[model samples]
Target: MTFRPISIFLSPNTEKDDVQLASKLLFKPWLWKKGKEILKFEEKFKKYLGARYAFSFNSGRSSLIAILEAMDIKKGDEVLLQGFTCNAAVNPILAKEAKPIFVDVDETINMNPEDLKTKITKNSKIVMIQHTFGWPAKIEEIKKITQESGLYLIEDCAHSLGAKYLPSQISKKLRRAKKLCGTFSDAAFFSFGRDKIISCVYGGMAVTNNKKIGENLKEFQKKMNYPSNFWIIQQLLHPVLMNYLILPFYNFLKLGRIFLALFLNLRLLSKSVVRIENRGELPSYFPQKLPNALTLLALNQFKKIERFNQHRQDIAKLYKENLEKRFILPFAREDKNREPIFMRYPLLVDDSDKILTKFKRRGIYLDDAWRKSPIVPPATDLKKIGYIQGSCCEAEKIAKHILNLPTHINISPNQAQKIIKLLLNAQ
Candidate 1:
């Protein structure tokens, strides 16, 4: 008997429009006027985020490097980051020739604000906070610490787009309060990658209210080009060919390892590793050029972001209602009045390895997302600053015990129920 496979996460592109547009663009090469599209996408995205400026890039990592470059973050400067996050978040700090100071995460799975204060030092120049799994960090407390210490705050909103965080008491008293997460930071970056809440197949954006950073990013964009036409064509065809055709073969044949190895070996999928300048070495900054095709794809998908976010929110709610008892759920901050567009539904469980094995036997897939700290040698002194030693203890425990069920637009209620039942049984 063939069992249905349940994946942990899926891109939000159920509509056939993305593929149709890709096909149209492929046929008419002249229609690939990326500059105009990129600018329009950037403007719309900026407006969506309520940010003053936005710039598109080939990937989230590149966008992050661009943000660090704009800020002039140099070698030896310590940037505080959460221990439990993707390499994309940490690699950029390394690219800037800076050292990442890994901080503990609170109950929300975001950076611990108190820990952030202790990490601040004379050498610390920036604090990079990720809104982990769509939960916003304690931005108000973090902002206060940064302000008092004269440090820069950079928000990594890779997991959050439609998410909102309410103003703090201080911010409310000021009458003109800043939004949490992205808005609280001096600059922020977002991803529209395949596994993200939004999907452009591959693309990212950098945003800021700071005029200088925006101008720098714009100047860099002027010199860059999109990925080649060949890449764009492949992306256009992937949804139909890879998702439906190739993926099924791999699943049926039980050739996942072989498939992954082959996929990684392909030149198109090879990782791009670029060395970034430390704080002071560059004469003039120019944003590195990314493939033009990615920019075009991101531009096309920017319009459907709201629908995508809504779907994710709905699915998250379902997971919460179904799985809350057996696992510890990460919820939107109660004090902050923001709705999160959950990128991943992370659950803390007991005996993760055993539960994962059980789920796998039942044809369910769960991601071991961000298990390793990308920052070389994770920080050891976070507790000195009153950071709860076990702040991210839940995440760390869940990282081993938790299972991420399919929470995408394509997942049916039946599929979700099946997953919930499995978890309940496991418990």
Candidate 2:
């Protein structure tokens, strides 16, 4: 049997008009990394999320750092965060010299609100909630708990760009409000990384409803040096190149990851460019400002995010209908009036090595592991960060078994079925 590879990123077909629009940035090199595009991106993003304030950054890790800087989460402070998320989210806590307290996630792979309540202490100053894989974590309950405990909330909306939070209690003001995923918390951040819902290749946004947090982010931005023009050009043009050339040959791309590891080791590639589950020490470039051209690159995709995300939902619905009972699927929390972006459909298997090998031979690709760390980056010893073992047992177990399959809009219904068939029969 001949195998057809499926892709989650690099799935979208290239549009000539989109390419022409992007070319406008290259034409005017003067505006390549300017404040004008950055301002425009923020304004439009703020309006779209209905957020009062929005600021762009070079990466989500930078946005997280600015949020912590704003909250004054310093050494001796405890930041309660779920262990089952990207290490980028927690690195900022350490950058602030604060200790991170691990919280367990529920079946949804989101921070369990019950576990959140248990982790808070007098030293706990902030709580970072990740809307894992576009699933809105128990937002209302967690928000209420954080508010009562006097902990500031930072919604890591990187995986959930358009995912929303529907309030259970609809008061007069709440009735008119749209509780988008990033807007529900004190301050939130979104990523435009290579694999995010809308990839601008490299960028992030810091958003908030509070004026003080906005000012703090601005102060942080003032200190950041702009990214290199070569890097900006590379990031700007990579998306279309990916969609047109690389993604179709994803298995080859998977093989190329070994070369990437070599490049990272040789220092030919920036460590920040490719994230690893166990990259021991973070690069010093965590907190940086966005380039004007990259913001323009992000804006082009942002305009089409809603449409792109809809296709993702259609694919997810198909997977939900077809893959049931065959696999231990991700959380399907009810009463979620908002739609999840469904970045990828998560699967929990007993033996990941068996599943990964079965698909790799068949030319199907899956995420290495949805972070194989109870405290993401399994190599990081909790004792080093002042966290204890046995704090989040479920996270450690799930990390070992969990992997995500592609749900890119490019996946045809027939292709999706092929994937379902493979996943169902793999074990």
Candidate 3:
């Protein structure tokens, strides 16, 4: 077999048309914002989620910032989120000057509603429920908890675009109709980063069904400015440069690795999380409007949402059927109506390091990239991010043993079989 790298960010969603468009738009960076593409993308996204309103931003963190601002999240107020997450999720709460109370996750790799109940206090204003790796959280139970506590609930759909949850008979208190992830909360935000279900290199969307929150979101969006032309150029160049300069040379003498580091160091490409964000400081440009150029790419991928998600579901099934009894796949089973997009298939193994090293040696680059710790970017200081170690024992234990396998559209069934076979052999 010819060796090829299988990684989510290695041009997984960037197709020929996307690259062609990005290349063409590179020279027209001056026309990057306030274009018809932005409005069209938002309208289509709203329709997709059956939401009353949608607003675009430069990143999912920016979208969350908009949601928090619109909700009037103020100083000393508490924002509760589960422990297994990224700084992208936590930094936004910090940006709003709110306290982030870490909640432990369950076997689903999502918020434990019981833990959520224990964490609530009079100061709590919102609960940010994440569909980690596209596994739907115990939303029905969690929603009921938030309702009883009178706390606003926001769905962090950054990892779960196109996923659905059908309420079970026991959850009849919730509307029994099937609901999309973003629709269940007061407001939800999605990421279109390079590795998300869809890619615009860097983009996000915020959606709300609440009329008052919708109006607030609209007003907040109006106050935000589009990113600068130079910044727009940086995003526009991402796919084109990576496809041309990075991936092709990546395994050849490690040239791609060197170029990636050089580009990030020289600021030719933007790091998904800036150094300061991991340090819990929000950058000035973190809360800007999504540029029209990037919105165009988002629209391109958004059109193929079903195709992308269907492929992911299929790959997840392969893992479920083939890797059974060999490894612990925590997020594999769901109720009939709950259709998860499965951005990455979560597996709990005895030694995460050993399995990851074995996969890497065989040309499969899957790793616990996002949730390496209770908070991500692994180097992030938990204290600075307000995570008290040992407070989330379940999350801390899962962090040490979790492995994520790629299930993006780029991985064909044949490639998925290879991954599954290798995983079984590893055990």
lDDT per residue (tens digit) for residues 113-168 in model 1: 87777767799988888887777777778888888888888888887876777774
Off by over 4 Å in 1: 1-4, 9-14, 28-33, 169-181, 228-234, 248-250, 255-264, 267-292, 332-336, 372-398
Put the candidates in lDDT order, highest first.
3, 2, 1
Off by over 4 Å in 2: 1-4, 9-28, 172-178, 240-280, 336-338, 377-387
**TM-score, per-candidate, Cα-based:** 0.83, 0.88, 0.95
Q: Count the backbone clashes (under 3 Å) in each candidate.
A: 9, 2, 0
Which ten-residue region of model 3 has the weakest summed lDDT? 1-10
* lDDT for position 118 in model 3: 92
Q: Cα-based RMSD of the predictions, in order?
A: 5.5, 3.4, 2.1
Ranking by TM-score: 3, 2, 1
lDDT of each: 0.65, 0.74, 0.87
| Model with the higher TM-score, candidate 1 or 3 | 3
Which tens-of-lDDT digit does each residue in 1-427 have in candidate 2? 3222565444232345555555566567787776687889999999999888888898898888888898877788988888776667767777777887889989888899998887788898988889888988888888899889988989999899988766878787676555678988899999988778876666899999898988988888888888777666655455444433444444564644454455445544343334432342456556778888877777878888877788878888888887767777875444446667788778777877777778767776664445466665556555655456678888888888887777664668788888788877876
